[model samples]
Target: MPGKPIVSSNNAICLVGGAPIADDAISAVFTFVNSFVGVDGGADHLLAAGVTPAAVIGDLDSLSDAARATFAQQLNHIPEQSTTDFEKALTRVSAPVVLGVGFTGGRLDHALSVLNVLARYAERAVLLVDAHEVSFLATLGHVAFTAAPGTRISLMPLGQATVTFSGVRWPFAQTRMAPDGFTSPSNEASGGVVTIETDGPVLVTLPRAHLALAMKAAVRAK
Candidate 1:
């Protein structure tokens, strides 16, 4: 069974999953998110934190009876085993950008799976945010954003790509990158604005403070 579709007026939505999410992080998500979608056990977390999501989407495997009772109307169960709950929600929702909390900072495998989903869904602008960092898949285009000087920026190739980047401590001019080979990590932004141009998909990571800039760039990239 697949989940019911969600119709959202807002272009951006927050996805709360079953990972550790800080209180401040939840507060920050609510500040910008026009709606919330809970993934299975994440609905329990949201309810525990006094948040009622617009919809709860998952395979119905991890959600508790108490959570189900509390938000029965919001449950949209998808009984498929092929995809993770995060991917299921991502495929079902329509948004210009999706802010993901509680999807990272968990078990290493889970975090890696989230990144894989971001890569697979390159057409969707999804930001996987944790306490310290924000990551998104960079598609074919020029992504420019503002960040503080000395802020950490990392670029990991999701697939085969040629990229050119500037406004950072180390600049790459038409550099070839691939998943099996090169990755630029621990790079620092040199000034207020940083830009990266890629012919294929890559993952861009930055400090959490630059969430607004990342979101802006993602929207522009779309």
Candidate 2:
């Protein structure tokens, strides 16, 4: 039910949602993104912030009439109820890495749905970023990033994953992790480089200060 896909030449793209996004968060995302794709009412938010998105994608239900008219040329509507705006926008854009802002720190359900999309599209390197934290889905293979010693790192399993970690205070060697099972939260990095190896999907969370490192790992993984 989606309209024509919007392609981007840039390797990195930013997806903006309707949730309350901080000014600094927006700035951080723009720093890496070459193009912006607004999701549903997110177009309005971008317009208010003096940004014109490369394209707007959604169900066309939440976007205001004025915004729709103003951005008609860039609007790509998908009148389907089966998928969320985030999924629609994410699937339509082809980028090596995506920085998602305004999708976190909102209603709990909305934020959870964003994570669901991340797991569903684990092949895509998407980072859900907010003012304080940056998170991404860790798929199969090893991912390495640089973080200061004693930096906080949280490794949470999306479903079922057996993972081994290094450069952390507590290493999980072939540990079986599940949503209802064990998880590593508030773990400190033991050195400048942190590594994680998993056979399945997991979520890696780090402080905002490590966004650059996280982005580097994501781009490398792709």
**Can you write out model 1's per-residue Cα lDDT over 37-58, one digit (the tens) per residue?**
8898888888888888999999
For model 2, how does the per-residue alpha-carbon lDDT over 1-222 read when each residue is reduced to its tens digit? 134458564568889898988877777777777888889988887787778889998897889787788888999978878888999999898878888888987799988888888887888889988889998887578888777789999998888999998999998689998889999978989987788999878999999878888887766443
Cα displacement (Å) at residue 158, model 1: 1.5
lDDT (CA) per prediction: 0.85, 0.84
Q: Model 2, which residues run further than 4 Å from truth?
A: 1-4, 220-222
